[model samples]
Target: MTNTAPSLVLPEISSARLTGLLEFLQSAEQLKDTLRSGTTANGRPESTAEHSWRLALMVVLFEPELKDIDLLKLLKLALVHDLGEAISGDVPAPLQTPGDNRQERERRDFLTLCEPLPADIAEELLSLWDEYAAAVTAEARIAKAFDKLETMLQHVLMPRQEASFYAFNLGYGVDRTDCSPLTRQIRDKVDGLTRALMEDAGRESA
Candidate 1:
């Protein structure tokens, strides 16, 4: 019978599990529609998904400098850091208040989103999200720092908004971004860009 290559076999996955996975992914598509406060160079409101994608790319580009950190974990943290925004949407940074319950709300939404996923997969993702929310691990901390930097970079590069918009970024997440010397240096560079943009906006309004 020529041994038939030892009869290849593959593990079976229940159809229900497969369906749940696909449903979860379909729900995640909402992220593509959740608009953030930042605009593109062309002045279109940027989506949360777009911001997350760029955040991941930023981490990959700086992987060489992010010594002793797990690159894969950093990327996952970046991607899912805002995944909950898909449901409740992003509250504009300027409107956010101290003790606003934003983090709690987002975590609830994240847990709901993972409900359709396999238990093991859901737990793993929840752990990552929780770590990022807490900024507990080195990977989580770096991801948080880059998250702030990426938002600052976007604000500065996008078409000029009101001077207040640029100013808002100057003081946005200093504590988070100040986690490391390199992150502080990057924040300073973005702050410089933000100042130039603020000036340009001021000139226009003058």
Candidate 2:
């Protein structure tokens, strides 16, 4: 009788590969210390890790309004969107200068960080990061919208005195045309909130 037993397929992961992955993870931990321009509810500056975590949650919270999207892909995009910032550090949009090589620098840093992983894993990560950076794909566009939305929300939530920088930030280019319906709605809401805050600040100063 011919043997009908299925052959066992062991995973190809090696100890050295795992060690490399671990090193990459350890390096990623630095993101927690990378401060962003936005502040927390308590007025402390926020970190890239905090921003990414909140952005991931925002994906789930806004999923209902973003129909037909691949939620898992969006989630992954949110998590890895700023992983490059782990090495490049957080640079506020308003502070970025024209002809700046920040994107190229971040891309190189991202590649270096991914180098420690297996080829397949590294390729997947690089692909995701590139997609998010390109912002051409539907998922990428939505992710970019959420990133701006989160920043706007943070600005609105922060104390008025501490958030004066937002006046300039609000005027910064935020194109809603490419965003999902839900993202557009949120953008409108953020606009309204920003206007109200500005008005309040004006009244208080007067």
Candidate 3:
């Protein structure tokens, strides 16, 4: 009783948690190096961080087009949308379909990474991630849609390479119109734009 509950030792707890978060976030950044077999405009492999960062800009572009959307929330969601990839790696759309892989798996991995975070922050971010995957709200839907658009945009920007065309032409399409109106509008524009890009790439290669 001489030292007032032995100083409570909370600092160590907090410091350890912080150290873990920093470690995980740094690891998250390296995920950008785990390429998706998708090339950039210059035909270079894309890192996970680069993919997420570019998608953020695409989300920014949709702010004006969204119907009663939360721009700031969407931006944050886009920023962390793929943070789980640090653990799961970049599991692109073709392989990550409805059943084989889902949000639950990603959420589990994200939760593990944030275990050091104050429970509230960890839970909240996880919830935001779930919301992003669900595409239930306007902000989340648009953020999620921008995620898809970014993949296509990468195809548009990619150099004349087989991977570039594969990204643009192979196994990519949108089914639901209601999930995102702005995204639907953008998709229409992307179809022709990506096609032309592919043609240009083909010409250059030829």
- What's each prediction's TM-score? 0.91, 0.88, 0.76
In candidate 3, how many Å is residue 87 off? 1.2
How would you encode candidate 3's per-residue C-alpha lDDT over 68-118 as one tens digit per residue? 777788888988777776777777665656676557676777777677666
Better of 2 and 3 by lDDT: 2
Question: Which parts of model 3 are misplaced by more than 4 Å?
Answer: 1-21, 161-171, 176-178, 198-206
Reference-based lDDT, residue 189, model 2: 82
Rank by lDDT, highest first: 1, 2, 3
Identify the runs in model 1 with alpha carbons over 4 angstroms from their true place: 1-12
Name the lDDT value of residue 58 in candidate 1.
96
- Clashes in predicted model 1: 0
lDDT of 1 by residue, 1-206 (tens): 46666666988799988988898999999999999988888899999999999999999899899899999999999999999999989998889998999999999999999999988879989999999999989999999999989888888778768898888888999999999999999999999989988998999999
- Residue 145 CA error for candidate 1 (Å)? 0.8
Q: In order, how many clashes per candidate?
A: 0, 0, 3
Candidates' C-alpha lDDT: 0.92, 0.84, 0.71
lDDT of 3: 0.71
From the highest TM-score down, the ranking of the candidates is: 1, 2, 3
